[model samples]
Target: MPDAASNDYSMLRDAVVFLLAAIVVVPLFRHFRVNSIVGYIVAGIVIGPHGLALIRDVEGTHRLAEFGIVFMLFTIGLELSFERLKTMARYVFGLGLAQVVVTGAVLASGALIFGAGWGQAAVIGGALALSSTAFVLQLLSERGELSSHFGRVVLSVLLLQDLAVVPGLAVVTALGSEPEALAWALIVAGLKAIAALGLLLAVGRLVLRPLYRMIAETRSPELFAAATLLVVLATAWGTAAAGLSMALGAFLAGLMLAGTEYRHQIEADIRPARGLLLGLFFMSIGMLLDLATIIPQLPAIIAAVALLISSKALIAAALGWCFRLPLPVAVNAGLHLAQGGEFAFVLFSLAMGAAVLPMEMGQFLLAVVAISMTLTPLLALAGRKVQARLEQRAAGGLEALMTETEGYSDHVVIAGFGRVGRTVAQMLDARDVQWIAIDLDAKNIAQARSRGLQVFFGDAAQDAITAAAGLDRARAAVITLDNPAAAASALRNIKKKLPDIPVIVRARDASNMGELMRGGATSVMPETIESSLLLGGAVLRSLGQAESEIDEVIEFFRRDAVEGGQRAADDEQ
Candidate 1:
């Protein structure tokens, strides 16, 4: 066995090698039109087990990578507050449910083809169903898609996966050498996990926010960091005590703190730690790229990548379609989600430890998962290209909306150009109303403009964004990102800065309506009410109620607006 002093020395040496390789190789990937993530993986191989064999602290390195995931979850939790999740109910619930069912089914079938037992197949399928939250979120963020319709769908599906992965981890853990007892343990563990999540949400709403506010008031970054760390550690400990993964507990802790005031600051402070650990993680994975193993396993590994991507992509596409997304969106979400991910390694490890899978299968799974991780970004780039091409072909019809409407000042401003909001803008347009559309969704802005509409790209929640959208010059502002929490926050900011700006906010359902009203929205409306009304109006017109009836209703609403009655805004968000 290696001496303790020698082990420490070797670990330090590996760190230098990993950093040096990352610095040199990252640039090369950019030059070659490859993703930075791909570069990191390649660099991992070069300085890891495959090339120089310079990294020796394999276990220690991965433990650090684990922190990369922890910080990452904290950031995700901060971003995805309950209010944000509310508006994304359709995608989160609809698309998310579909992705889990469909993808899990497909992967399980493939495992069955390999003659695995039902329990093993369940483990494989469920594990395969989880896309890499870390990788996909980072990619979309860099490409700026975390807020688009498709991005919303991806986000929803990812959230579901996060919730689902906990059970998956339990499932793998339960299938120990004594399968029957393990199965019962797994069932008990899952129930406990669900209870923990409920407790997290409850405690967060009741206690975490106040605690964080108290910390924030002190203006101590160190104290804030310590509190965050405490939350994660405590929650993680609680979860393990109940027989779940510590990661799951950490994630719940993040979810609890998501509603806190210091979420953004906490994320900022912890990000540096995440960044460093992420590098070390990639380095550790690189060490696994042993040339000796890979050379013999290349064919099988490449085949696994193809199989995993193709299979998972098809399942994801079906789920997207089931969620009623546009065809292009469905296809792209599928492709983007096709890869095997880091969790595959986790599941495989558990499987190996339990002797459910041979050591050979675990090694093979590692190689295949690594390859799929490398391909994920490439798949995303491909999806972007495909989406662009589809948009270009569809641009002819979009041009009609871009015909340059003049006299936009002192008019209404719509912040998001998504389909629902765009429809509202169009209805107002047919009446020759003056309004300028603002959106952070570049795709939506581009599409809107291609059709002859006057839409600008912007984040309307920011003072800078509203200023760019001519908020002060505009008579009214419509908050329409479909995210209730963000919408409420934006409404608050607008009220503070320009108290007289009449703001109409949208909601997914009644539960969201009150929050916006409390936040100072002039009116709040749900999608269903408006859609039903439009259909009712068309039927009335067909029955010969006369165009005057529609005109009269509009006039009445305008009159009601003076006294602030129930005219309900568009709920497109």
Candidate 2:
């Protein structure tokens, strides 16, 4: 056996090498707009035992790297609330369930046609049916597409795939065991999963808030960070011990904390760790690529990858259509989910270990999965092209409306249809003024239209949407995007097109007020200032102050807020 000192030194060296490679490669790829995932994986290939042999203990590195996925799932959970999940339940459960059933059945039949036993074929089919949630979600997020219709559909299917891991594991475990025992194994697994989830939900409901409250009361950043990790790992462990996947446990823990006041703080603390660890995870996946075996089987590998992408894409698209998604959205979602997922590694490894899959077949399938993951970014690009073409075709039918702004002269254009924008539009309507609104949310547009409001479904910041909304002839534009960056972006886009038009933009706080003003907003109303002024007025009224006195005080403060920006401008001059 190696000396302890030598082993420790070797481990340190390998870690240093991996970090160095990531630091160099990830940014280089990102600078060119490539997914950092691809960069990290390529770095692993160059430094791993299979390539330059710079890192000899690939397995050890990979084990450590798995934590990245855990961190990612935790963060993903933090973003999701029960309400959000409830809204997407039909797609998440109905469509997600269908994708797995249909994709697996078809792929399994294909495997059977290739002469594999039903048991082995089933394993292969189930494994391939799962797509890389981590890869697709991260890719969409990097592109700022997660809130888009396509992104939500992709998420629903990926979420179901993650949930399906439990039963998939059970099926693999029961495959080579007694045939009658299969039912018992599934029953036991299902009960354990329910018990684990129930316990988590109960604890989360009763204890998580108070637990965080106590930790927050300490007012120690170090303690808070540690407590966050503890919660994530503990829940992950509990679920794993309960025979469910660790990611599921982490996700549940996140969901529990999501509605808490400290959700954003928890997310902020976990992000750095998630990014680094996820990079490590991606690198480890690259290290697993067996080029020696795969190169000789290139033709077959290519065929398998093509078949998998095509079949899964078709299946997902069909499901999307059934769910009533637009053709482009449904097709894009299908492409996003076409690649095989990280769970396939777990599923295949278990199946091989249980002797349900032959050694040769298992190795080949692993290569197939790895190659498919590598092709996902490329497939995503293709999906974008397809979406663009469909969008162009749709635009052809609206060319006259898209270009004609003559009838919209002096009409107010609201850039969002959320509460703030809705309030502004209602006031305009009350005055009998003409107005049109555009919002990114389709549901919001539909709801507003149902209420007899003139709201269009499109991104306000997009030049096309703004033009379609008749920005060139509008009396003024109101920007009320909740996201500060989006608000600033819409303001700038409006100014670029109609440089002299009055644009009133909302700011989240005083800090963003100047930024929005500089972004060419005619006036920036910070929500903080407005709320404080309103509160002051309400308090004075409650204290029985005369209405005139309250009005006088409010008017003075409002004048000061507006002049504060002018004073800064004068100072700059």
Best candidate according to lDDT: 2
C-alpha displacement of 208 in model 1, angstroms?
2.7
lDDT tens string, model 2, 1-573?
569989989889987998899989999999998888899889888887678889888777877887787888888778878887787799988999999999999999999999999999989999999999778878876766666556777888888888888889999999979888889988999999999999988987898899889999999999999999999999988999998878888988898888889999999999999988888999999988877888999999899999999999999998888989877778878898999999999889889899999888998899899989988999899987676556445433125336444477888888888889999988998998898877765556668768866666556777877888888888899998877778878887888888999999887777667677667788888888899999999999999999999999998998788778656655554
Give the TM-scores of the predictions, in the order they appear.
Answer: 0.69, 0.87
C-alpha lDDT of residue 479 in model 2: 91
Which candidate leads the pack in TM-score? 2
Candidate 1: worst-modelled 10 consecutive residues by lDDT: 396-405
Model 1: residues >4 Å from true position, as ranges?
1-11, 31-33, 117-119, 240-248, 394-573
lDDT of 2 at 250: 90
Alpha carbon RMSD to native, model 1: 12.7
**Model 1 C-alpha lDDT versus the unseen true structure:** 0.72
Q: Tens-digit lDDT track for model 1 on 259-355?
A: 6666777787777776776666666666666668867879877887898898888778876777666666777888888887677777888888888
